[model samples]
Structures are given as C-alpha cells and as structure tokens.
Target chain A: MEYVIHLAILICIYLILAQAFNLNFGIGYQFNLAHVASYSIGAYTTALLSTELEQGFIVCIIASTLLSALFAVLLGGIATRLKADYFAIGTLAFSFVVSALLINWKSLTRGVLGITGIPRPIIFGRELNENLDFLILIFAFVLLVQVFLYFIFRSPYARSLKAQAEFEHAAMSLAKNAGLVRNLSFLIASGLAGLAGSFFAYYINYIDPSSFSLTEMIFVLTIIVVGKPGSFWGVIAGTVFLVLLPEPLRFIDIPPSILGHMRQLLYALILFSVVWFNKANLFPVQRGV
Target chain B: MSLDILPQLLINSLIAGSIYALASSGLALTYGLLKILNFAHGHLMMVGVYMFFMFNDWFGYEVIGSAIGCIAVIAFIAYLSLKIFVLPFTRYSYVLSFVTTLALSTIFEAWISMQFGVNVKSLTTGFQVHSIEFMGIFITPIQIIIILSSIALLGCLAFFIHYTPYGRRLRAFSQNEYAAQGIGVSKTNTSYVVFIVGALLAAYAGVMVGYETNMQPTMGNAYTIKAFAAMVLGGLGNVWGTVAGSYLLGLVENLSIGLDFWGYSIPAGYKDAFAFMIILFVLLLRPQGLFNSKSRAA
Candidate 1:
C-alpha cells in the first residue's frame, strides 16, 4: 500500500509537469526546455524556505509558484523573440545556467552535497506526517490543475495558441495577440511546474541537484510525446502509463546496479520506437508559404 | 592582473576554441542542410573518444592508427544513426527529428554507463606530458597536435564546401532543397555525406577532448551546450561564422577565469553559465549573430 501511494504521488507530480509542458510545446509550439529549471527553482525554493526559514506549506508553495512564473516571464521575454529551433537552444542554455547555479552556488544551495532532512509541509496547524496524507494533498492539487488546464485548453485562448503555432502571421493578421498568449501560457505552465517541484521537495523530504537534471526533463518530455502532443486526455493517459510501465522491472532478478540504467535504456528505446513509428503522424507539419 | 598570464591564457583559449570549432562546425552543417539539431551530436563525439581509448589505450595501437580506427568506427555508427534515427524524419517537422536525437542521446549515455561504469577514465597517451616553453609561453605536445589537426580539418572543410562540385551541390541544396532536387541532387546521397562528415569532425573533437580531460558519460552534455552556444553566436547554420564564434567564446570564457574585474572574477565552475549568458545576450541584442550581416533564414 505504501509503495502504491508512492507511485501515486509520483504520477501526480509528473502529471502537473506534463500537462503544463503540453500547453507550451503541444499547443503553443514553444519548446521551453527550461521547464525543468523552473521546477528546480520551485523545489529549491521550498527546500530552502522550509529548512532555513521554517516556512509553512502554503507560503512555500505560493512563493515557489510565483517565483517560477516570474522566471517564465523573463525566459519568455528573452527566448520568445527567436524562432522555434533557436528558441529551443536558447531555453536549453537558460536551463544550463540554472543547473550551473544550483551546482556552483555552494554557499546557498550547499552545492552537490544537497539539502537533506527537508521538513514536510505543515498544514492548518497540523503536520501532514502520513504518506497517505501527502498523497491526498498532492492528488487534490493535481485534480485542480487538471480541471484548470481542461478549461484553458477548451478556451479561445487555446485556439489562438494553436493558430499561432500553425501560422504566426495568420494568427497575428486575425488580431490574436500571439505574443501575449505565448507569454501567458508560458507563465502558467512554468508556474505549475514550480508547484509540482514544491510537492516533490515535500514528498521526498530531501532535495538535490541530481533530481532536476536534464535526465528528469527527458522523462517528462517522453510523457508528452508518447501521449501525443497537444492532446489533454492523451497526456493524462501517457502519464499514468509511463509512470507505471517501469514498475515491473523491480520484480525481475536483475542486479540493482544495472536495473537503474536498464530503466533509462527502456525508456529511451520506447521513446525512439514510438517517435520512429509515429514520426509522420505525431505533430502536424508547420505550414509554410 | 599581469602580462604573465596572457600567453598561457591565450594558448588555453586557442585549444578550447579548436575543440568548440570542431564540435560546432558539424552541427552547423547538419542544421544548414536538414534544419534539424542533432542533440546526440556530442554523444557521438563521446563514443568516438571511447573508441579511441579502447584501441589506443587498451589495445596498444599506435596513436595515428587508433585515431583512424576510431574515425572509421564512428563513420559506420554515423551512417547507422542517420538511417535509423535521423533520416526518416527529414520529410516531417524538424522538431520530431530533434526529439529523436534527444532519445538517441539518452540511449547512448545509458549504454555507456552500463558498459564502462560511471567512473571517470583517463586516456594514457603512452608518453609523459611534455610542454614546450617559448617566449614565456608553455604549450603541450598533445595540445599542439589538437590545434594543428583542427586547422587542417577545418581548412579541408572550407575547401570542400567552396572549391568542389560536391561542395557547390551541398550549398545549392541548403539554399533550396526543392531546386536542388529538381536539378537531380539526390537528397539521400547529400544527407549521407553531410551527416558522415559532421560525425567525423565530432569524433575527432571527442578524441581531442578525451585527451584533454577525463572521460565520462556526461561529458558530452556540456560540450553539446557549448557547441550550441557557439553555433548560435556565429549565426545559426553558418559554418565559417561558427569557427569565429567558437574562438571568441574560448577567449571570453578564458578571460572570465584569468582576469579579475573590480576585484571579482567569475569562478571556473560557472564557465558553462558564461556560455549561456552569451547566448542570451546575443539572441537579445543581435538575432542575426554577432558577426553575420544577413539575418538567419526563418
């Protein structure tokens, strides 16, 4: 039961990330790879606040979300001016900067030693000590985000995003504020990623630079791609399936040493084959003049 | 603070720039031709370095022999990767092609770690480290080899891209793929040649970098970002500009470490961050690239 709950919480965290990422890459066609960086910011913020300042759950979550959103605004400001491929490269550079700070700002982040013994969230004058309690809290937040995203995807704003993605000039000629829509979606997506990061810090009770590296980013990217980008129901299903897919590896009689890499290898192969088979069908080809 | 550190820093910068040039030139070519960024480009470099180590260090092959064997092996891998991982998506969106390379990168890193263990391994060059001192400057023999080889290779590339019929065909294709195809420039043949050449350059860079630093699975990640920054700074898809941008990056990165500004100097650990800052600043200030006059083709 505890193991099951752990998996559930992991799913909840990834769902928020994938759903948010879907809004950017899937709908807006903005390949903002700094998402994991924003998530790292949220996690690190919560970790520092709770460990150093003795902040409560609400304060940390709110701070992390807002800070990540602010980061998104800045990132979007710099990267949105570029085209798709350059935008991806630019955001990737920003992600590297964030990772550098995390690892090199030894005085604040304690460097690679990592911040440990992070206190779990204190809720309403009570400490949520139970694993089940944390799972419930996380699940509630996930549900809220999913519903919120569902509405956003259905709105005219989403249509504008898709329009801009398909044809920026056409969307602009149609009087859609393409820039504004891109920034708004970017802000919301990164903010939600931050929220997920906060939950990750609380649940794991330890936060490290290793957890937020590019490898983790690839995992989330795999979820959206496999689920079929730009589809709400698809990402949700992708999240559940991918999160649970590797669970069966535990029962195999492989050495623990190789098992971890085996999982990564498995995911890589899956991602490759899926993209290979569905390359033609995955995303609509960007319309050119 | 003194003139003393200038010579060493300049030499260091040159060495670093050469590696960056080698890495990014291939990236620029592939992007120029296919408009796809192979995220696994650096990982292929890593594989080349390992192959060199296996032949030179473990099997006791001569230095030149090992490099040749490594290049041949990497060429085969490059051909396989182009066919299996990169080519299928050429007709589709470049974004999907990018994702495929990303997946390929993950596969390479994981497979390497499982095989070699995660420990950093050093390349034994079969000789003691020898640095030649001239006019208050010290240079290593291996460093000299790296710089010379990079120049030779890049010179050959420039000659190929400018002086040969094949080169004209390549340039024509990058300019207008449909027009090139209309003139009977086979897409498959062009992609295979460009892809293999790019891989060869990256493999040579991998061997040089392995000589310069300890080998590890994740080493490719930093190089990929650096190469991207170089490619962008030089102007996306501009091969000559990439070389200049790389040399500039190497100088700036070295200067950040070697010189103190206002009693403060950037730490060596933030060298990669400096590259990122350069990308951000360049993208914001001059989207056309720092040196390039023409804006990139949208």
Candidate 2:
C-alpha cells in the first residue's frame, strides 16, 4: 500500500512536469530543453528557503513558482527572438549554466552532498507524513494544475499560441503577436514546472543536481511527444502509461544492476519505434482548433 | 602565475581546444549539409573511443594502429547505420530525426555502460605524464600531437571541401539540397558519405582524448555541450568558424585561470559557467556568432 502510494505521488509530480512542458512544446511549438532548469530553480529555491529559514511549505512553493517564472521571463525574452532549434540549444545552455551554479556554489547549495531532512507540509493542524496523505496532497495539486491548464488551453490566447506555432508568418499576417504568445506560453509553462519542482522536493525530502539532468528532461520530453502534445488528456495518459510501463519490468528475471539499464533501453526502443510509426503526423505542428 | 605554469596551461588548453575543434568540425559538416543537428554525433565519438580500446585490448595493437583501426571501424558502422536506419526517415520531419538521434544516443550510452562498467578506463601509453622540453618550455608529446593533428586535419578538410569533386558536390548540396537533387546529385549517397566522414573525424578525436584523459561513457555529455558551443560560436554549419570558436573558448578558459593575480583562483567547476556566460552574451549581442553573417539557425 505504501509503495503504491509512493508511485502515485511520483506519477502526480511527473504529470505536472509533462503537462507543463506540453504547454510550450505542444501548444507553442517551442522546444525548450531547459525546462528542467526552471524546475531545478524551483526545487533549489524551495529547498533553500525551507531548510535555511525554516519557511513553511506554502511560502516555499509560492516563492519557487515566482522565482521560476521570473527566470522564464528572462530566458524567454532572450530566446523567443530565435528560431525553434536555437531556442532549444539556448535552453540547453541555460540548463548547463544553472547546473554548474548549483554544483559549484558550494557555499549556498552545499555542492554535491545535497540537502536533506526537509520538513513535510503541515495543513490545518494535521501533519501529512504518511505516504497516503502525501499522495492526496500531490493528487490535489496535480488536479488543480491540470484544471488551470485545461482552461488556458481553451482560451483565445492559447489559440493564438497554437496559431503562431503552426505558422508564425501567417499568424503575424493575421495580426497576432507571435513573439508575445511564445513568451507568455513559456512563462506559464515554466511557472508550473517550478510548482511541480517544489512538490517534488517536498515529497522526496531531498534535492540534487542529478535529479534535474538532460536525461530527466529527455524523459519528460518523451512523455510529451508520446502522449501527442496539445492534448491535455494525452499528457495525463502519457504520464500514467510511461510511469507504469517501467514498473512491470521489475518482475522480470534480470540482474539487479541490469534491470535499471533494461528499462532505459526499453524507453529508447519505445521512443524510437513510436517516432518512426508516427513520423507522418508527429513532426508537423498541428493547427489549433 | 609562474611563467612555467602559464606555458603548461597554455599548451594544455591548446591541446584540449584542438580536440574540441576536431569533434565539432565534424558536427558542423553534418549540420551544414543536412541542416539537421545530429545529436548522436557524440555517440559516434564514443563508438570511436570504444573501438580504439577494444582493438588495443584484443589485437595488441599500439595506439597509432588502434586509432587507424578505430577510424575505419567507426566510419563503416556509422555509414551502415545511416544507410539502414536513418535514410528511411529522410523525408520525415527534422524533429523526428533529432529525437531518433537522441534515442540512439541513450541506447549507445547504456549499451556501452552495460558492456564496460561505468568506471573510467585508462588508455595512456605511459607517456602521458612525460614532457618534452622546447625553448625552455615543457610540453607533453601527446599535446604536441593533438595540436599538429588538428592543423593537419583542418588542412586536409579545407583541401577536400575546396579541391575535391565530392567536396564541391557537398558544398552544392548544402547550399540547396533540392537544387542539388534536381541536378542529379544522389542526396542519399551524399548524406551517407558526410555522416561517415563526420564519424571518422569524431572517432579520431575520441582516441586522442582517451589517451589524454580516462574514457568513460558519460564523457560524451560534456563534449556534446562544448562542441555545440563551438559550433554556435563559430557559426553553425561553418567549419573554419568552428576551429576559430574552439581556440577562442580554449583561450578564454585558459586565460581565466591565468589571471588569478592575487592568489585567488576560480574553481574549475566554474569554467562551464564562464563558457555559458560567454555563449549567452554572444547570443544576445551577436546571435550570428563571430563569423556568421546571416541570422542564427537553430
């Protein structure tokens, strides 16, 4: 039961991550590989504030979201002027810079030792320490984020974001500010990622650079792509499918060391095969409804 | 800094920069010709390093012999893989190819790690620690080889791209793939040759790097970023620009360490931050890079 609840919490965290990434990559058609960097900023912010100042969970979450959104604005301002591929590369460079700062700022981040013993959330005179209680909190957050995303996805602003993604020149001719839409989408996506990161740090009670690597970014990307971006339900289903798929592999008769590796291989193979099978429809940006 | 220490660091930086140039030049070629970012380009280097290690271990080949063997083997494998797997997806969207390459990168890294444990393997010929004296300056032989080989390779590449028929065809293709295809150039064959050559260059760099530092599965990650930075700095799809960008990066990093006049030094880990800052500044102020005349392409 505890293990199931733990998995549930992780699924919720990833759902938030995948959906947030989907907002930009899927809706805005901007491939921001540095999304994880925003997530890391959130995680690190919450971790620092909670550990150093003994701030409550709500304050840390809000601060993380705000800080991450500010960073997104700056990064987006610089990157939105470039093309999609350049934006991806820029974000990747940003991720590297952030990761380096996290690792080398030993005075602040404690370098590689990583922060631990983070206090969990206390709500309404009740301490949520048990796995089931944590699951409920995480699930509620995920639901709230998803609902907000759903409304945004249906908004006129989102329609323009989709239009810009589909054809920037055409959208501009149609009187849409493609750059502004791209920047706004990026900001919202980054803010949500920060929120997710805070929840992740709180749940794990620890945070480190390794948890927000290019590999992790790629995994979230895979989920978004596999789930068929731009569709909210697609992202939710993708999170559940991808997160659950690897679980069954644990039962297979394989060496403990190789088991983890085998799952990675499975992900690679699945990603390749899916991209290949969906090649015709996958690459072209879908028009906003 | 002491004069001796300054010279040593300069030589070291030059050597490292040369290797970075070698690997990144190959990446630039593919990007130039295909307009596709080959994310597996680093894995091609890894395969090269692994082949060199395997040849030396299994066949008792020396470093030079193994380097040649590694280049040949890597080129063939890359050619075959491109022919079999990537060619079929040529008409597909660019993102598909990017994702496929990324997936291939993961598969290759995981496979290598599974085959050889994650421990870093030493490939030194017992001469890595030895230094040669020239004009009262001490330089390692490996460092000398790295610099010399880079110059030679660049010269050869310049010759190939300028003087050879295939090179001319490559240039034409890169200028306009559709036009080249309209003129009866086989896009498939050109892509295969370009990929193979790129892999060969990357493999050669990998062997040299393995000799300089220990080889590990994850080494490719750092090199990938550095190569991308070099590619962007030099102007993507420009070979000469890549070489220039590499030296610029090497000098900046080396000179940063050299400028610690008050006995205060920047930590080595901050080197990447320094590089990132430079890249960000360049991208913001001059997105076209130093040599790039046109606007930035992805």
Report the C-alpha lDDT of model 2 over A1-289, residue by residue, as the tens digit: 7778888888999999999999898888787878999999999999999999989878999999999999999998888988855666677788889999999999999888888988888888687898788888889889899999999999999899988888788889999998899999989999999999999899999988888877787788789878997889988899999999889777777778777667777788888888878878886844444
* Location of the lowest summed lDDT over 10 successive residues in candidate 2 chain B: B84-93
Instruction: Report lDDT (CA) for all predictions.
Output: 0.89, 0.83
Best candidate according to TM-score: 1
Model 1's TM-score against the true structure: 0.97
Candidate 1 true-interface contact recovery: 0.81
How big is the positional error of residue B106 in model 1, measured in Å on the Cα after superposition?
0.8
lDDT of 2 at A54: 88
DockQ of each: 0.80, 0.61
lDDT tens readout by residue for model 1, A1-289: 9999999999999999999999999888787889999999999999999999998888999999999999999998988878878888889999999999999999999989889989978777778889999888899999999999999999999999999988999999999998898889999999999999999999998888999888888888899989999999999999999999999999989888788788888888888888988988787887887
Question: What tens digits encode model 2's per-residue C-alpha lDDT throughout B1-298?
Answer: 5465776677767887898888888888887887777777887888789888888976889877887888778878898768655766667666666677788887878888888767899675844377888766677777788899989998988998889877888899878888998989887777787888888888888888887777998777777778888877888788789888988888788778666767888887788676677667677777777897874454
Which docking band does candidate 1 fall into?
high
Q: How accurate is candidate 2 locally (lDDT)?
A: 0.83
Off by over 4 Å in 1: B296-298
